[model samples]
Target: MPNPADRNAMLEARRTLKMAQSPHAYVRGNTAKFYEWLAASPVSRRVPTGPAIWICGDCHLGNLGPIANGQGSVEIQIRDLDQAVIGNPAHDLIRLGLSLATAARGSDLPGVVTMRMMEEMIDGYAAAIHDPTSGVPGVESDIVRSVERAALGRRWRHLAKERLDAVEPRIPLGKKFWELSAEEREALTTLFAEKHVGAMILSLQGKPKDREVRLVDAAYWMKGCSSLGLLRYAAIVALKTRKGRWSYALVDLKEATTPIAPAAPGADMPDDDAERVVAAARHLSPYLGSRMMPVRMLDRSLFIRELTPQDLKLEVDQFSHGEAVRAARHLAFVVGTAHARQMDPATRTEWLAILEADRRGTLDTPSWLWESIVSLSGSHEAGYLDHCRRYALAA
Candidate 1:
């Protein structure tokens, strides 16, 4: 159990942070309590048979998005792992389930209808992971909307040439975000910028020319509303050997915390984020964490892996009525898989039933209500952000 004092303090901090217009900022300090929660629960830590990758901790509708691939294929896949922990299959599901519930509250769709979608998604994942042969008809354990490799690789080159707002390296921001926190900037720049670039060149596979070697470049990027004030930097590591030829590596560092709920806020316990991911991956699904590299340095949690382009999802506002439901259905399976992955077989079965029940009740609702929820959420988000901004200026 977490200390009583710590829990109270976190709740108060969350209020302050929320008042500062930072709903997008992730701040889950003392999240270790979640691990403790899972342990005490009746969930099993056994891994199912399959290839696993590092599970995203905070996977939800908003977190899924597109990434460019080295091959130019714009694949869709899962992203975000602030609360990610190495544990069971379904840790992220809890977040997904609640998000769906909260999301539904804002729309005109009856709560029952949204619940049905959630149920379908959950059952889909159960069948996919447990009995692939059975062929459950849904999306779970799948990277939400990731694209293909060859295509992503092709898209990557094209994107590189164009000006990407955040994902692609097109802008020439020569280190202005650094002024915000000079101490953090110096510490990170010294670690990642110049030194890592030199090391990357030697890691090159074949020999080339020294004349071919190019110095790596570094720049600060400002994006992601939740992570707005947090630190972020990227470096272009191009490799060259004794012969004149070139290859490149992309490395980045960013704030790893999640947006704080109005009920809680503050700097997250630095090491907890990565630890949660590793522990959950180790316990719930080893395959997911296989290629995922987890490390923490300079009091920050970091995960290193190939930036996947296959992962993708459409923006929420972009979706129409039918499209939103489709999105809900897709998210359902992913979240279900996450929950079942963590809990014991019995618990999984029970959750499956409850979620199914939630789904069936929605069989008769009007779809317009669903759309209304999206609007409500947006309004609430705006209202909350405004409230927080006032305090930020005060502080």
Candidate 2:
């Protein structure tokens, strides 16, 4: 978290340094720029607008991962809902294409491989749109398999070790977790005292519904690249599991800001930012949505969710040609199913036809998808370089 003394300057410095690290990292952080280019470029006119539904406005590889539900079963889904909205599904496709293309480039894969991966991406998405009940795909790529294995074996102890560096039920004040103000602590305690909040947390533990919950520890959490300056906190809540034992769970409280990702024109959305996020999340990712609660604290709109050990983001730094292609298809299928669930049979068929109509001879993918990725790749490379230079000068 940014120090209250110089919050903006500190946050800007941290965000600039993180984004300057790599092109893929920059793509993940610079979502506003991606939308700006899409809106202003001539390609925007050629893009087909699909049915208005809840979409992950930032559908990058990093945003899609293994998310666990109340029962602790994990599945590949969109893990972040901070930028979700009801909008054209095409925006998600373009954003995901840019993400995979950048990841391929960062891995030093051949340009031909990147082209083939895009085709497979479309194929994977179309397959799910044809059958929404396919659910999460079987693990095919090595990177995905590795992450899946880790997620399956994780428990509360694993989460504690990683997040707190100990098995004790407390958030250690350190780099990732900082000390909070007195007022902030009091507000969080009051927020957790509500019956609804306790029920949500206890839902994961299989404990008595009426069990009393206590605020064990909390801190200002400095997490994520894009949401660096936003109000975020890591809270530990404890409930007595039986007469002699207590159970603990980690809860994440993040402020909901107005999304930079634009919604479809005249789309019906909740006026409250937190409500909009939770509602869109329920449509886009059920496991996560079922665990989320919208709340107001310290006069700010915020959403709280339990952080399970099974919720792990895919950390794909390097990829072989085969892994790149397989990953493209698998992750796209995940996003496709999310979108397909929101469409009727007729709407799915119509959108699928529109997607296929732009393909030319010998090319399996849509021409506009290919063109958008090519244009955005070049633009982001330039943007990434300029960002590094600016950071260097500032340093």
Candidate 3:
């Protein structure tokens, strides 16, 4: 067990992380209530846990997306590990369910379809551990397909497209990620063809080609709220391990760890923060590939990954009732499995029961559970906004 000081510091880090990423009007409005709730809740301590391995700490809606495999086979994989940690299972479940609630604010599906979609996500997560290859029922391994499916989702299809006719996502990224500019096009070209990108030719995992391979720039884009002040880059590479087969690989590298935290007090020395984050991500996400370099710059850390087409995030509210229920259940199962992996059989079974009971409608979907998270998220958002306001006023 970690000492009290370390635990307190970690909590402070989380609050600070929130402030650094969200806006002020958002932060001030919701801060104190959240901290108070956390302090009062017995379950809160069970969360914010650590010393395990690889947790998607900030398991929010926007943080999840699509990514392709080495052969460009699209998978419903999770992305955005910037806030990942090796810690408490409760933290992930609470945050994930809370994000689902936030997404409920904008879903297009009635009730059923929304439940199904949510359930599918949870199912997807659980299944991933066993196969890591199962995608949607019939789609081939390709990024475009994942993007299309994610765009349509279950609720949108059931709503007959009526649900999404007017709704637009509140993606934090600028519009350019969905579009492209001339300079950005050129940059993508360069990244893919030179500088950074490559295919592994041999069946070996640790063996290197004994040479630096250049990649072409795949896209010009922007992403992540926490990485507002850091560098993010992506490149494309084609690999042909077999004699006649060829496939595209999209490699991406982004900066994580923000320059500030809302709930946490005191100024941060960015250099150290960047180092810790880069180290953690690299250490935890081994699939980030062996040769992938996590670079440290003056004020930021760069993380590398294969640009998979299957990456996607869904707005929970837009889904149908069924889809939402499904998604919730699906997410619940994944959270349960992750927790089970780190705990004793008894502890694992306990949470699994809680998750399954809720999913099967055996337990009343606790309105209070999601409400608390929203309260927490809202508070952090407020605190963050306050921090930003103070900065803007100073500037």
Q: What is every candidate's alpha-carbon RMSD to the true fold?
A: 10.0, 1.5, 11.8
Compute each candidate's TM-score over C-alphas. Answer: 0.54, 0.97, 0.53
Per-candidate local distance difference test: 0.42, 0.88, 0.43
Between candidates 1 and 2, the one scoring higher on TM-score is: 2
Which candidate gets the maximum TM-score versus the true structure? 2
Arranged by TM-score with the best first, the candidates are 2, 1, 3
Off by over 4 Å in 3: 1-53, 71-75, 108-212, 215-221, 236-249, 258-293, 297-300, 315-317, 339-347, 350-361, 365-371, 377-395
lDDT of 3 by residue, 1-395 (tens): 22335434444444455445433223222323443656677545434322244455556555444433333333333345555544544455556655565455445434344334345544443443333223233212223233546533333123222311222311122332333345545554554444333334221222244333444234333433343334454444444433444333445556555421122223232344434454444443333333254554333456555433234554332444544565565544444334344445554444444444435443333333434554665655555567777656754
Using lDDT, rank the candidates from best to worst. Answer: 2, 3, 1
TM-score of 3: 0.53
lDDT of 2 by residue, 131-228 (tens): 89966454356677678778989999999998889898878887678888889999999998999899888877788788989899999877876555
Clashes found in each candidate (C-alpha, N, C closer than 3 A):
93, 0, 82
